[model samples]
Target: MSLVRKFATVASGTLMSRILGFAREMLMAAALGTGPVAGAFYAAFQFPNTFRRLFAEGAFNSAFVPLFAKEIEANGIDGARRFSEEVFGVLFSVLTVLTILMELAMPLLVRTIIAPGFASDPQKYELTVALATIMFPYLMCMSLAAMMAGMLNSLRRYFAAAIAPVFLNVILIAVLGHAWYTGADSLEVGYAMAWGVMAAGVVQLAIVWIAARRAGISIGFRRPRMTPNVKRLLWLALPAAITGGITQINTLIGTAIASGQDKAVPALAQADRFYQLPLGVVGIAVAIVLLPELARALKAGNDGEAASLQNRSVEFVLFLTLPATAALLVISEPIVRVLYERGAFTSDDTVLVSSILAVFGLGLPAFVLIKAFTPGYFAREDTKTPMVFAAISVAINITIALTLFPRMGAPGIAVASVVAGWANALMLLVVLIRRGHWGHDAPLMRRIPRLVLSSALMGAALYGGAVWLSPWLAPPASLLAQTGSLALLCAAGALVYFVLAFATGGADAGMVRRNVRRGSAAPAGTEE
Candidate 1:
């Protein structure tokens, strides 16, 4: 399928999920606010999510997809099926043991690895541990879900897997809303959210399983055995894990530093929810859809096609991300206020979250580019190169966090993350150029200035629109007015970006129009 249509399929699903997720967080803010309860829940949520990123999103997908794609290309349907079953068996066993151990060691793990924010207050620390214990097993369900997702992607069934996350947000929102309506305590609502997380994982797994069955790739597990394929997956997964670890270390560092400052960790987490919307919609969708295609192209020795896909992915990411970064920065305050300034969420909390959001906005494009760029290396089974670059970025993040946190508070850590992201992106780009995997294309070169100019115009329009609309949406606002203002501002920004992009030849209106018309008719793989 065409890249644009493939991206749209995944992106539309992801956008739905993100919208529901935003509603979930809004309910959470109204229900728990940005206090100790919110802090505790954020801490608990981060524990599973950290591993989710490490195992499900980054490490597992990186190691599994390329290998699975290669196997399917070479060994046909049955051979690939056996490889998936073996991998799943090992993954299930390891994750089961790990989950059990983690639950048992919840207190110490929370105090040490995840929630340093609780250290000063015994009650909060204990609460975080308790919630974490409740949620810890989510890792097992999600790890399995990741395997299912990988299998589905290999079969080119992207819709169900992409749409699964929306169920999570829906379930969480329902649980939280039910709890609040029944006048449940904040702690009770928090527990409901935790339970909802586990439930969502189950649902996600089931959805993908159904998709696999329909694709004629239903998997069954046998006794865990150390087969050569399992060992090979392990070998690939280990370095990928370390690489994933380096990326995650920055989160751990941010959590550690943010813990010392009251409410900073949760504030940062809330801000991150906004940043992740675009990243998830564009960055992750592209990565998931592009990686398997790139792997197949490389395995088939279609170097020119692979290069074209890589270049297009980069262009696609830059075209969307640059303006997103600007809009997030421009509307950070009103966005936070409109969504979260209620109940226990004070004006001060809004200010804090907005500041962090702006700081995060600067790095938004960089982070997305990292996702777009890293797949190039992984598709070739060259995990080590990205690992080295990720290590350098981690070190840079650590140093910057240390130096900046004292001076800028939580926002400092956010800035440091952006810097680290750029560092990683640049390093990856440099290595790709050196290795002859990517280079300047005439199309990209010609499009660069136009893209930047369009984005700048969008930025100015968005910032001005937000400023003009803010006073009307300020405190003492009705929910309708606030919501309406935000909707209008976003519409205006989008219109400006698209119009300027089309008029200036920054983006192809006809291509986008054709993509929309073609819909699901686009090919499932990269166009040669």
Candidate 2:
């Protein structure tokens, strides 16, 4: 299989999860809208979710995969399995204790760290505490699940791990949709979703754990033995954890500040749901696949191959991101209106979330580029650099968000995050260049300008398409009409971008087809 197909396999799974996640969010929004119930739930969910993203999608994967790949290469599968068992043991034990502690401290933690703004309302504050406590053990399930996923990705078994997240969305959508249909009270619905989250966590862990077992990489609990390699893994993981932690903390800060404003919490969450669709399918997929591929390339002393992989990953990700960014920027309101304007989700909610989504679109490319580029350092076992850069980005985010929120409201928080995202990406790229890690290849350099041009053309086309489709863009009409309008605008934009890309030789469709057909799946010369 080719790299594209491997990425597609992972991406396809993610695409499904993302699609289901969109459904889940839409259901949740209609059920609760940007009301206090939605606010409390989002705030509570972010508590663990912020940390989950840190480990599952962010630092742990960066630290674990390369080291695991090296262990497999140097010491064979037996040694690698042993390493995984020890790590899993440690992870399970630590998270078990952590979950207990967090559960015990749920109220205090909610009052302090998660959302102090809720303190003014006894009922709201207590509900968030209860909601978060129900979901806290998700930390335990997901921590182990993340390790299992790392094991699977190291073995180039991407599908199950990539698709496991869909269970979460599935559970949530089922619960939320049922609650909505039954006209469950907001309080009843919130608790239902909270418990549903924890249930999904168990199922998510089971899915990946079973997949790893089927792949002959069952990570049973062993004694938590900290060998030299374990130490090395922890050392590498520490900085990456801090980096992921800092970034999540910045998000927490944004949420905390946003929570103070009326309805800002759910507004931001709604906007995040839309933007995360593209980010998940493109950025997350590239990062997960790129990290190990680059690691193996460097391990084999194929610097040229490593550089090429990085460049191609960047090009491929940008090819998707730029146009998506344009569409979101151009058609955010209509998209949000079409998706979430029913039930309790009001016109005011649409306006706020859409504006936030549009600003977030500006940073979308940078967010994905950071995901694509950070692997350059991570693949080389250097997490401290990203840690430093992440700290810088966090500081910038806090300052800008704090400064702007008083003036611009929830949208300002989104804009601050966008600005900080660009700053972080630029910094990482600069460092990668300075350290001689990832130099831009000639192809990358040549094609980027053209990619931008193609994306611009698509953006214009989408803008015109949206203008033409406005009357049919919103409901009080048929769902078919509204969905058809949005889908048509998106398809037209995609058509324009790809047509221009192939016409100008910006992206080689034939090459993509050939490569995706019979080309590098895990790179040209890596162990399977």
Query: lDDT: which candidate is best?
Result: 2
Candidate 2, residue 328: how far the Cα is off, in Å:
0.9
Give the Cα error of residue 85 in candidate 1, in Å. Answer: 1.1
Per-residue lDDT tens digits of candidate 1, residues 479-517?
889999999998888889888887888778653553334
Candidate 1 lDDT (Cα, 0 to 1): 0.82
**True-structure RMSD for candidate 1:** 2.6
TM-scores, all candidates, are 0.95, 0.96
lDDT of candidate 2 over 1-528, digit per residue (tens): 567777888889899998998898888888888988899999999989887877655657899999999988898888899988878777777777878888999999988889888888888888899899888888778877888888888888888899899899899988987887898998999999999999999999999889888877766678887878778888888788766555466678899888778899889888888888888899888888888888888999999888878877888888889888888888999999998998899998999999999999999998888888888988999899998998888889989999999999999999889888899999998888888887657766777888888888888888888888888997666888999888888887888999998787778865476345543444332223
Q: What count of clashes does model 2 give?
A: 2
Candidate 2 error regions (>4 Å): 244-247, 509-528
**Alpha-carbon RMSD to native, per candidate:** 2.6, 2.1
Error of model 1, residue 316, in angstroms:
1.2
Instruction: Specify the highest-TM-score model's number.
Output: 2
TM-score of 2: 0.96
lDDT scores in order: 0.82, 0.85
